[model samples]
Target: MITLDARKEKVGDLLRVSFQTQIKFFLSNTKTKAAKSVIYNYIDIFTKDVEIINLMKEYEAQTNKKLAITLPSEEVPSRDAWVNSSIIFDSRT
Candidate 1:
């Protein structure tokens, strides 16, 4: 039987690989700017989630490698925008 920590580690690795693959597929196959924008927004939301951030951090620490999702330069949001948006939503609840 697999231990709990080992399972978690495996899941993390899968998550990272799956995310990378999805991004590559979308970038290559997506044809319209509007559709790509929507997809990028969803990706931003997923990557910015607190739980996902923590998981990525833990994975990086374990593997000694960086796992980052890069978007097109034009589609990338500023750091301040991310922080402010999170604060706005966090304050609402």
Candidate 2:
């Protein structure tokens, strides 16, 4: 359920875009003091997982570009890092 609004690209007719997708914190740890504010009001931080696509096409032709980005973990939060890398082990049911 991700929606990207591309209304900011007024660059070349050969379209270009830069985007960094983010995961917002809503309904946070309601049982913990640490996330009180995040639970009360919607909270958000940025992440680079958001995929951006750019295409350059003549009005009736197909065109494309490779959209590769870097998501260095040191630059993102580690709070829930385990959720993304718990695939290597078949232990602990």
Candidate 3:
């Protein structure tokens, strides 16, 4: 049987790989400079979220126990960020 920790680790790895692939695809295929800029900013924000990183580490440390993750109450990238991203995405299609 696969252990819970192993399963979690695999899922995390899969998500990271998936995001990386998507980012690469967008960067390569996105024609406009503005769209690429938005994607780059999103990547920067994601990588700099220390709270999320800490939460992940905590969860990894307590894999065997049932732990409730209380995400940071404050939104990371605010609604404005999504609006910009959405506009960029929409422009591509």
Q: Compose the digit string of candidate 2's lDDT tens values, residues 9-73.
A: 23211221211111112112222222232212111222222222111111012213222334565
lDDT of each: 0.48, 0.24, 0.43
Off by over 4 Å in 1: 31-93
Q: Flag clash pairs in model 3.
A: none
2 or 3, which is superior by TM-score?
A: 3
Best by lDDT: 1
Poorest stretch of ten by lDDT in candidate 3: 79-88
- Candidate 1, residue 92: Cα displacement in angstroms equals 24
Decide which is better by lDDT, 1 or 2.
1
Query: Which residue segments of model 2 deviate by more than 4 Å?
Result: 1-45, 50-63, 78-93
Q: Model 1 Cα displacement at 24 (Å)?
A: 0.5
lDDT of 3: 0.43
Off by over 4 Å in 3: 1-3, 31-93
Write down the TM-score for model 2: 0.18
Compared with the true structure, model 3 gives a TM-score of 0.33
**Candidate 1 — which pairs collide?**
none
